[model samples]
Target: MAKKRKVVDAKRDKNGNITDVLLEGNKNFTSTEKALGMTKSGLIDLVVVKRKDKEHLRTRPDGKKGNNLDEMADD
Candidate 1:
């Protein structure tokens, strides 16, 4: 089964980039790479996309902005 928890929050660096994300039930933030790994392993519900030479995680399309990576980072 796919993971039910979604990224509800985020942790960012001084550059204002999201370095980590917080799951629905997780109190501590998890690295984006780890989350990406989980997404690859079918443990978490996400998509891996290549941008230039790097892979990034994105939420499945649901026509909602609340769960978008950018909004989550604003929290």
Candidate 2:
């Protein structure tokens, strides 16, 4: 299989919060902004969430649906 490529290179502030994101590959900030209908700076608000209330979200008996694909789709 071919190795996966990194899609974003993040720049963080002094507090370690991401302030900017440089998209990898052929896409530039202008192109991404145009396509996404928003400025590149708008993407800085992206958050990573961890559910502390629930051990897991999925309730499938087989446990196959708890994988990464299912989690990503929920986002």
Candidate 3:
């Protein structure tokens, strides 16, 4: 099986929300749609959630809170 990808870094806006995430050694920011697609394909080690008619990306049920996208911005 192929290795799963991870968002090692991220770019945030003024509100501190993640706008784009860095995939390992990627130079360009990954789009949300692309990330969602990857999540569906199981390429990325994250979860996809649909809420309020929109799709949101989040980490799996891991014990580490910092691994979550929201906290990844801070770290």
Best-fitting candidate, scored by TM-score: 1
Return the candidate ranking by TM-score, descending. Answer: 1, 3, 2
1-75: candidate 2 lDDT, tens digit per residue: 333222244334476433333444635432322323232224322223337752221112344543322332332
lDDT of 1 by residue, 6-74 (tens): 777877788877789888888899999899888888877678899999998888999999888877887
lDDT for predicted candidate 1 compared with the true structure: 0.82
Instruction: Give candidate 1's error at residue 23 in angstroms.
Output: 1.1
* TM-score for candidate 1, residues paired by index: 0.84
lDDT of each: 0.82, 0.33, 0.81
Q: List TM-scores for all candidates, in order.
A: 0.84, 0.27, 0.81
Q: Which digits, one per residue and each the tens of the lDDT, describe model 3 over residues 38-68?
A: 9899898878999999898888887998777
- Models ranked on lDDT: 1, 3, 2
